[model samples]
Target: MADTVSPRPLRRRRMAILVAALAAVTALACWGAYRWAEAEARAALTLNGDLRLGLYASSIRNAVGRYDYLPFLLARDHEVLDLLDAPSDLRRDAVNRRLETANAAAGSAALYVVDRSGLALAASNWADPAQSFIGHTYDFRPYFRQAVETGSGRYFGIGVTTGLPGYFLSHAVRQGETLTGVAVVKIDLEPVQRDWAAGGERVLVTDENGIVFLSSHAEWKYRALRPLPGAVTDRLAQTRQYDRSDLPPLGLHDGPLMENGARLVSLPISGPEASRRAFLMQELALPEFGWTIRFLSDLEPVKAEATGAAILTAMGILLLAAATALGWQRRQTLRLQREARVTLERRVEERTAELLTANRILRDAQEELVQAGKLAALGQMSAALAHEINQPLAAIRTFVASTRLLAERGETAMVRDNLAMIGDLAERMALLSGHLKEFARKGPARVEAVPVARAMDRALALLASRLREEEVQVDRSIPPDARVRGDAVRLEQVFVNLLRNAADAMEGSGDRRLTLTATRNAEGWEIRIRDTGTGIAEAHQFQLFDPFFTTKEVGQGLGLGLSLSYGIVRDFGGTLRAENNPEGGACFVVQLPEAQ
Candidate 1:
């Protein structure tokens, strides 16, 4: 056995060990908190950066695409074609003035016409005394060569005459099969740069070759994002794309890799000292223009926030350790915790009961609303039923008066015919009443093969007196065998509703014409009812088929005719739509599927 150690020395050694362990744990906790906070902050920054990247991409695309149609449209202008077809000073002057006006209106940098040999025939800047593109020859430009070969081309380069940069859009002008010339529109993209500069975020737009053509920072423009190969540099020089020889690198150094393909990068700020800063870099591609957009988010604020979180975490760990050393105090409050738990349980039960009562009340209110809707629908159906019967009643009165006059003259044949017509009218009224009752019950309509011609004839016969009173000219183009799958009585009711609406629409019109046309399609038959009257209001077009929607005066309609017709057509597996005719008036189309 070893010699006995002193208690004071042993206790002191154990205490020292404990203090070392605590210090290590506290440091580790703080580091973990800092890492977590920095990661969370970077994730948020990446999300926001990606959003800004997309918006910047869209702005660039819209700015460039707005001028895309200019070149193609101007290529077909007669003046441009004439100037290309026959070169003359007189025609050239006329075209130059026309182009100048168009350029100003379109807000393009320049508009010019080039003939087959790539000679500028006329330009928008022909009147510019300093330097005009009128006499400039662009046979060597890639846009001119490409347009001649492929009928159209697009390129971005520095203008040789003006020494200014622009995006060039070209379209080939053709005469019969021969290529005549090319129309070119130059668009200035500096406004887009200015817009980006106004925003707080830093943005850079680069082409396929990694050359930054547009940047929020003017100093970054024309700088290569990466090292350029010999071939790329040669091509750039040949095309005169940048109009600069000393193309410096942006010196963007990659840092740590990030989630979602985002990464950390160090960018050099513009100054004599050339200080560098860390950025969370995100990239988005604009495939339409074969360009890439980069968004840079500063990370200094994120670092500061993480540092503060680390300090708070260190303090929390110290407090947690102290609480652990004093954990025996929790035992003293066990009885009080049990009493509080019981009280909480009782309160929860009371709240649950209250919620159940509220739910029952809500259900009862819902039932009441449903019942109120049913009653309203019944009222609308009653109004629609009366409106349907009034028309036949008027016609019956007219026929009955005619029959009495004929009977006095002893024309038994005419009286018999009038009696038969009255009987038919009475049956029709009864049928309509029955159908309306069925509709109120939400029952389906009877389906069968109904002839379109017969339906039109019956509707027209019913409205003959009204048509005569309104002096309406009826035109029919319905085929004899044109039929559809639907309930005949309901179908006839549809036609009557449509015809009455048309006639009413033409009430005060100088020319009252009702055109009924039916034609066969691949799937079924399309029947159109058109009226030469005041057209439907644009504000009410979409709501025509909605229940209780109407434009008629009081007592004239129940606002249920179109709604009922639309439902009837839908029940037959068909569609009914209304539109304002381009010529005048309104047209209602009913499309029904073909009968097997």
Candidate 2:
């Protein structure tokens, strides 16, 4: 006796409701599965990226530290070169003893003493003693040339003698600034190769000409290296990381093909000499030697996992929809109608909430992405900046230490001059440090009154230890009464930076002399720093104050010191200038308003 209904219409209505429910469930399940897969993939990729980068960085640090230590080791054993200069028979005995001692300490393959003419006079290994190497010419060796010409040290590739892959670290033996001979130490590449193998990564060490001298993989040993296709080789020439795209497709497996209609992610391993565009994928630079390391991995398993998850989600949705349809069929007609309306309303509300949540998450992710980008940029700048700052600092330290030694030895006149140079160097360092701090700061400058001479003194004091080690001469001509009304800290910083620059200018030059003169002029109190070293080029004078305009080698100078100092001086009512002195050197002049 209930309201009569056509069976066909009822059946049609039931089918429509079941279909709608099934579709809704399928869409939700698919979306959830997609999000889950995306999250997992992102996590895995991030982890992989971190692990590879960490390993690369650690390896580079080790290499740099090892190389830096080489010079010190050679300097310590300088007496061996003298021993090799004796009669051939006596030289052989002394040289062998010294070689054995050095070999024991340095774990080197062989230690050889080469004469001024690049003749191997003595050998370390007893099996091939000095007699075997006596009169053997090595003028063709790069390390020998570097030692004779540069009068410093250099790294050379494997030798023709042993036929084993190695590096020759050569130091010049100077007799009062005259190159007497060279001390060559041979370091085998086997240990470093072993290190690379243990790290689960392959490393190929090449020279400037792309000739591979050492490789972790034995098969690649002594191979002539070619650029990896698309790899960034410039930074790699020092140290760097590239992703898959940065490299040629020759050596790597293809990454996972993304399903779920999302964009595919390709990992790039960059080469050492890649370009800026080449770093579109993940890239890091090694500013030291321009070397690059690339990391690549397969992503097929990730794609398969995502695809399977999507299919499983679709099947689960179908089952859920079937259950929903059965529940609807079991209900009374009136109740079924009521429940259907409620279900549709609930689904709409739930969808709206999900959309809102997704929007918020997307916004958060965007912000995080921006911050990450900023940090990455900062990381790239850090190495170059540190290197630039360190050079001046090292120089300043040398000058300061020299001044201290002069003072301790009761050499008042020399001490005074050295202190002045120390002060100047300190000012230069302070300026550099200030600029670095400001560059990294998120705020404005804080100014205060600072005494000029006191600032200079503080700068000198900071470098006291290093100056003594280098035995550089310093001359200060500033009156103790000099003072400047400005941001005391910043004023000192400027002077320190300028002084440090002067000290750096004298590095490696046998005649290390720095002169500082401070006097009251019509404009203000003027301080001039002069160095007796290779003068600046006339062409580069204008660009000296430009940011990142350094004439130094990679990682040596950020070229921001003069620029920052100029800004600071102008802010505090001062002037800074530079010029080539008539006496074969460079001079920097700083003028600050006299304290009222």
Candidate 3:
């Protein structure tokens, strides 16, 4: 049912397609070669510019270092010291001659000394009366104020005396605690600019305020790289950083940018050359002096190579495009397959992350159980607190009854004293309650040095009534000077818990003695609270300090006391241990490092 075409016409069609492809590929190869040559030329230019900048920066650093050295040397001179001690006119000439000789030897533009009043007392150029700095006041200058206040300073300005732009390095001359005067070395910074100009390279140096003070291009000097704030502009005017010159903003259009180590931003140069001007702008930071150095290279010079590249490359692009089309199609297919697999893997990762988050939630729920245990420990302390307050209240009730009898007898002074005594007892009860509330509070998770005797005294004061009521023989052998590093309140709690346990353990014993002993060894501080009772049974001794393990009757204690105490000690880089003493008592020993 199909019409069969001649084989010769099909062969002719295939030959025509092959010939067209060959022609296209040949054109593409020629275009690629031309473009490659142009890229190589631009790369060479970038490398050459970078090398030149490095050399120039190195030379600038070396020159800048010279200005720093001369002032430090001049400040220490004996003649300069003498002039600062006494700004007498009789000493001025000798100081000037010595300065002039030193200035010439050191290659400084000028060397001068200013008094406390900022008046030039002596100078190296005193021989030329026209250019002499003597008797001229520089109080308006930043260098004068900086040197007096900071002991060293640097400033760039135009000289009022010589009318020359230069950098002034200044140091304070001190005479035993008093600031006497300033020693200054003025150095001309123009030679570097001159060298740059001679090489036909444009460079600019700007201060922290972005005001240009040095430049190879004369028109750029005294211009601001950025818009200056009103206050800064006024300050500069007052200090005369640029003398009477009106500083203007550079007004650069921040558009295209390229970089290697240098950020090349295009700056539009105004005037007749503005239309053809395109410059490569880069900056280097002089962090020590809080200044910036800007470099500019004109792109107009490289236009010839670009033009030639375009003209040569235009002849061959279509051919290369035809030759690479098949390979490009195959590459696109492979990329699509890879992307699909990556998308599937990313979905798996997202699901895995969700699982990990669920596991974290489970871990957090487990943590809630531990916090509940801490709250339960607080609940257990409620009984001890009530017992502590009950004793004080009982005492207060007896005092009140006694006071009523004293009032009826008209023993006015005795009644007053009893009332005062009642007040004291009330205050004591308040302090006890406050201490309990604070002890149970979960605030201020911090630790500090805890003095052993002081903390023990606090605990003993709380338990004093209990001990007397229980007829407990208390033998405390703790030295006043012993100290340990821990949370003071927590350490006090440890002692309170130990004391309460001691009193309870010795309840039925005939001889009830709570002996507290504290001693310092080379490693740390050791404290022992020993209660003379029917000592701990052998079976319970091993689990004495474990959580929820207690020898006392249920509801009498939380079993968390020793467990929490052990944890607190461990957290403070210490240890707590319990053992039945050989001398017939249960002893709780706490070892803590001495406070650093």
Residue 377, model 2: lDDT of 13
Predicted model with the maximum lDDT: 1
Candidate ordering by TM-score (highest first): 1, 3, 2
Model 1 spans with C-alpha error above 4 angstroms: 1-11, 325-596
The digit string of per-residue lDDT tens for model 3 on 375-433 reads: 11131233335545654576677777879999999999999987887786677677666
Candidate 1: lDDT of 109? 91
Q: What C-alpha lDDT, on a 0 to 100 scale, does residue 127 get in candidate 3? A: 90
Whose TM-score is greatest here?
1
The lowest-lDDT stretch of 10 consecutive residues in candidate 2 is 372-381
lDDT of each: 0.80, 0.60, 0.72
- In model 3, which regions exceed 4 Å deviation? 1-43, 259-261, 268-276, 301-303, 310-596
All candidates in order of lDDT, best leading: 1, 3, 2
